[model samples]
Target: MNEYSLLVLATQYSFTAAFAAMAAGTLYFMMERNNLTPEYSPVASLCAMVSLVAAINYFVMKDTVGLDGQAASLAGFATDYRYIDWLITTPLLLAVLPVLLGRSRMNNGMMARLLAVDVLMIVVGYIGEVSINRAGGGTMTGWWCLLISMACWFYILYVLFAEIGRALEGADSYLKSSLGFLRTYLVISWVVYPLGYLIAVLDLSDNLLIGREMVYCIADVIAKVGFGMAAVSVAKRLSAMQWEARS
Candidate 1:
């Protein structure tokens, strides 16, 4: 890569690292604010922390990874992506499981159904990723993974928006705030992955040259930052609400 390309990569890494730190902090605060009963808090926090750690590791090691060829250091990228997916989605599934199983008293049938759908979507995503990795030619299987990821993202956004609407209906400030943050975060964060896939699929590198790699890096950074911000915003909102109720 040229000097400009190298600079772009460095910038991207910095952005991603910053976001990872923010995510970790956000999750820590969330656990404390929500009073997430030891059982759920640890898992949720683990999700955020793992994501943060993976991002940082990727950022640090990005320079060492080759991205010039078809067989470029894909293993490192795949490993990081897998870690992120597992961390982010697994805890979310855990949180939703209770609602789906009818163990929670919150009693929103629609939300429960949405959670179930989210779980299914995540499952599909994992399968798609596995298929892509095994196929290795980045053809049908890669497209399938990209498509499934987009589908799942849209559904998740729908769920967040629906929750926010419901919270508004009840005038529940905390829930509304939480949902709003989630909506913003999801929308922004999810954009990166799709964009990266699009760039790859379209073969935009022909025109952009090494700049294309920078695009992927930038996308990763944006997504991580959005996630971190959303987590922190939700945690703060919940904490304030709890304090208000107590007073």
Candidate 2:
């Protein structure tokens, strides 16, 4: 347990809050445009609010929860259990979101790709959780989680980028304009996790005190900021497409 570790946990929690807020906003916007139905919008909003609440809880209870320790910390608990729980449940919920919200006229290929990616991410997340739990060593388990997470994230990023490109092919002005920013945001934001994992693998933290901090920072940024950006992007695209049909 140390001050640095506490700081790391606090940072992680803050990032989660930021992500949840963004997700809630995205879902709300999509609902307004009829991209997502009212029923599903409430669910998405609830999840987002939960994420923020969990983040706050972690931050507020950090010290009492042994968050300064390497093996037992608030951030560790969230990543090792809570976040994994969400990852597993989210895909199942999402599998039904499209059905409940009804389908858009957008490319089926893109939707299929996203669905596939979500499934893969859930599977990979489970694998990561299992691997880390089994490894049972600080650096060892962390490395295992980092590797699996990076792999899954990279795959997700690829799918998202490819789908956006496909959508841009003959997209209208509004859709294209929105996607241009979305693409850049996704590519850059998603890089944070992998970069952090790479740093961990290289064992560069020995020379750089900031290395450990970077690892937690990247994880938080990717999970929160990256996911938020994605939710917003998808919501925007779907909403705009619906509007185009009406007009």
Which model scores highest in lDDT?
Answer: 1
Cα error, candidate 1, residue 65 (Å):
2.0
lDDT of 2 by residue, 69-174 (tens): 2423433433344344345434433332233233442456656766676656555545554554454323555566566666666665665566545545655566
Count of backbone clashes, every candidate in sequence: 0, 0
lDDT digits (tens) for residues 1-247 of candidate 1: 3323444444345435544554554455445535543333443454455445645555555545444443233234453443454446434533432221222324466566666766665566556555544654355766776687677767767655655354356545555555555556556655655565555544453334234445545554445444544554454444555566779
Q: What is the lDDT of candidate 1?
A: 0.50
The C-alpha stretches of model 1 lying farther than 4 A from their native spots are 1-138, 206-222
> How big is the positional error of residue 175 in model 2, measured in Å on the Cα after superposition?
1.0
Per-model TM-score versus the true fold: 0.59, 0.53
lDDT of 1 at 216: 48
Candidate of highest TM-score: 1
Q: What's the residue-level lDDT of 16 in candidate 2? A: 50
- How far is 82's C-alpha from truth in model 1 (Å)? 4.8
* Prediction 2 global C-alpha lDDT: 0.47
